[model samples]
Structure formats: structure tokens, C-alpha cells
Target: MIKHIVMWKLKNPGDAAKFKAQLDSCKGLVPGMREFEAAVRTEGLEANVDVVLVSAFDDRAALQAYLEHPVHVEVSGVLGGLRESRTVLDYET
Candidate 1:
């Protein structure tokens, strides 16, 4: 299995909820998407990042398919402008 994890620091922290909602729209959009989750940092937490995504795929190919899917592409466009910084980690499990 492949795990894809990402963290984002938004230009405006207030936009976290909106960004998470937009990201949630991409769930189940493609095959082999075993798990998909997005969350914002809890209130009063000493965290720099605003949003995080934790997802699982069958393999690298499955992860690639999700990245290239139209829904994901559209979601990325929206996220691109809202985020100031982003980080990602992918690994087999």
C-alpha cells in the first residue's frame, strides 16, 4: 500500500474549513483510493500548518491516478491560491 500525507499552511488560517471542504469533494473520485481524510489544526494548538491530508492507495500507480484525476486537479487549483506553503510525504506500507 501507498500512503500519501500532506500538510499545508494557508495564506489565511480562517480559510482552513473551506479548504478542507473543497478537498473532501475529491474523496472517492477515482478507483483504488482506499482512504481519504482532511483536517484542520485544533483551536489553540501550537501548529503552523492549517490543513492536513492523509490518504492511502493500493500502490504508486493508484496514487498517480488520484493525482491526475480531474476532480483532484480542480481541487489543487483552488488549494494553490489559498496555501502559503505545502509539504508532502509518500511511502509504501
Candidate 2:
């Protein structure tokens, strides 16, 4: 399986919830999506990132399909202006 993880630091921390919700809207967008989860930072945590996503796919092709899907493109559009910084990791497991 392929695991795709991403963390984002928002331009406005208050928008974290909205960003996470937008990401959640992409769940089940394509076949071979094993798992999808999005969450905002904890209230009193010493974290710098505002939002995080942890998703798993059957393989690289499945992961690619999800990235190229229109639903994901829309989510990316919403995140583009709101995020100050973003980091991503993908690996086979």
C-alpha cells in the first residue's frame, strides 16, 4: 500500500477547521482509497502546523488518481491561498 501524509501551516490559524473540512470533502473520491483522515491541531498543542492528512491507497497509481481527481483539485484550490507552508510525504508500506 501507499501512504500519503501532508501537513500544512495556515496563513490564519483560525481557518484550520475550514481547511480540514475542505480536505474531508475529498474522502472516497476514488477507488482503491484504503483510508483517509484529516484533522486540525489540538487546542493547546505546541504544534506549528494547522492541519494534517493521513491517507492510504492500494498503490502508487491509486494515489496518483486521487491527486489528479477533480475533487482533490478543488480542495487544493481552497488550500492554496490559506496555507502559508505545506509538507508532504509518500511511501510504500
Candidate 3:
């Protein structure tokens, strides 16, 4: 299994709600994705990242498919404008 995790630091955490809705649109849209989740940091948590996406796939190819999907492309378009910084990690178990 592979886990693909991404964190985004937005220009404003208040604006992140829009990005959350965009990400929710991708639920069950990506091929070969076993699981998908998105969330934002809570108040008083000292969050360095504003949004986080955690996804699971059978392999790297599955992750790649998700990355190349049209739905994801649209999501990226929205996120790109909102993000100030981003971080990502992919690992297998």
C-alpha cells in the first residue's frame, strides 16, 4: 500500500473553506484511490499548514493516476491560487 500525504499553507486560513469544498468534489472521483480525506487545522492548534490531504492507493501507479485525473486538475487550479506554501510525502508500507 502507498500513502500520499500533502499539506498546504494557505495565504489565509479563512479562505481555506473554499478549497475544502473543491477537494470534497474529488471524493470517489480518482481511479485506484482506496481512501481520501481532507481537513484543516483547528483554532489554537498552532498550525503551520492550513489544509491536509491524506490518500491511500495500492501503489505508486495508483497515486500517479490520481495526480493526473481531470478532477484533480480542477482542484489544483483552485488550490494553486489559495496556497502560500505546500509540502508532500509519499511512502509505502
Candidate 4:
């Protein structure tokens, strides 16, 4: 299995919830996606980023499909415009 994790630091922290919503919209958008989750950091948490997305895929090919999927491309385009920075990790699990 493959795990895909991403964290975003938004230009406006207030948009964290909105960003999480956008990320949530991607749920079930592709096959071979095992799990999809999005979350915003708690108000008092020691988080370096505002929003985070965690996803699991059946395999490396599945992860690649998710990245190239058109729905993801569009959503990511919008999300990309709102974030100051992004960190991503994809690895076998």
C-alpha cells in the first residue's frame, strides 16, 4: 500500500476550513483510493501547517492515478492558489 500525506500553510490561516472542505470534495473521486481524510489544525496545536490531507492507495500506480486525475488537478489548482507553502510525502506503508 501507499500513503500520501500533504500539509499546506495558507496565505490566510482563516481559509483553513475552506481548504479542508475543498480537499474533502475529492473523496471517492478515483478508484484504488483506500482512504481520504482532511483536517485543520486545532487552535492551540503545535502545527506548522494550516491544513492537512492524508490518503492511502492500493499501490504506487494507484497513487499516480490520483495525482493525474482531472478532478484532482482542478481542485489542486484552486488549492494551490491559496497556499503559501506545501509539503508532501508519498511512501510505501
TM-score of 3: 0.92
- Candidate 1 Cα errors over 4 Å, as ranges: none
| TM-score winner, 2 or 3 | 2
Instruction: Tell me model 3's lDDT, rounded to 2 decimals.
Output: 0.87
| Residues forming the 10-long window of minimal summed lDDT in candidate 2 | 41-50
Residue 41, candidate 3: C-alpha displacement in angstroms: 0.6
Q: Give the alpha carbon lDDT tens digit for every residue of 2-93 in model 2.
A: 99999999999999988988999999999999999999999887887889999999999999999999989988997899999999999999
> lDDT (CA) for every model shown?
0.94, 0.94, 0.87, 0.92
| Model 2 steric clash total | 0
- Which model is ahead, 3 or 4, in terms of TM-score? 4
For candidate 3, give the lDDT of residue 44: 85
Assess the local accuracy of residue 10 in candidate 3 as a C-alpha lDDT between 0 and 100.
90
TM-score of each: 0.96, 0.96, 0.92, 0.96
| Candidate 4 lDDT by residue in tens digits, 1-93 | 999999999999999989988899889887899999999999886999999899999998888888998989999999989999999998997
Q: List the residue pairs that clash in candidate 4.
A: none
How do the candidates rank by lDDT, highest first?
A: 1, 2, 4, 3
Candidate 1 residue-wise lDDT at 51: 96
